[model samples]
Target: MKDGQEYLLFLTPEQDGLFGTRGVTFGKVPLNTEELEVSEDQIESSHTHTEKLRTIFNEGRKKYGK
Candidate 1:
């Protein structure tokens, strides 16, 4: 992930400094494309509405203590 670039990361629990289990991977992507400093190998898809995603993510983080 790039510094100050907002990225949504879908990560599994870390093991030995790596996320996910064997043969599995997740994505970390920023919605805003204006400052895209780099690209990722895999990017997960989501609903296009940014506000809705914010609500969901915020609520989840609050409730789940992540």
Candidate 2:
């Protein structure tokens, strides 16, 4: 993700109870259309590893982006 940009992230805690943002690049999604920078584009363009997140993003956009 880029600095200062908002994202819809899927976070989970490790065995130590500390949250990990490690999959930001693979599962996280940008919150705004304007925030679809290179990384975000890359994410949408390739869904081999992120089909669920992509589906969520699409459903959200269709439902909320009126």
Candidate 3:
């Protein structure tokens, strides 16, 4: 990678280190594309946005512990 280049990473937690979705080949993708595709969708949530975030954080704390 060059000095100023940026990339998007898809990673999974590992005991040794984070690994890509499918080994090194699927690790990262360059974000320097001329045209990038984006899509937006709306979904219903049981909790308010802040409450949803708090719920997520609480779940993480349960998994990894505080």
Give a tens-digit lDDT track for model 1, residues 1-66.
557655456666676887752222213334444232332443234445444444555554454432
- Evaluate model 3: give its lDDT: 0.42
Candidate 2 Cα misplacement greater than 4 A, ranges: 22-26, 34-53, 60-66
lDDT of 2 by residue, 1-66 (tens): 668866665577878778775464534657666333335554566656466656666665565454
RMSD of each: 7.2, 5.2, 11.3
Say which prediction, candidate 1 or candidate 2, comes out ahead on lDDT. Answer: 2
Worst 10 residues of 1 by lDDT: 21-30
Q: Is candidate 2 or candidate 3 better by TM-score?
A: 2
Give me the overall lDDT of model 2.
0.58
Better of 2 and 3 by lDDT: 2
Displacement of residue 56 (Cα, Å) in model 3 is 28
In model 3, residue pairs whose N, Cα or C atoms come closer than 3 Å (at least 3 residues apart or on different chains), thus clashing, are none
- Runs in model 3 deviating more than 4 A are 16-22, 34-66
Task: Give the range where candidate 3 is weakest over 10 consecutive residues by summed lDDT.
Answer: 34-43
lDDT of model 3 at residue 11?
69
Give candidate 3's TM-score.
Answer: 0.36
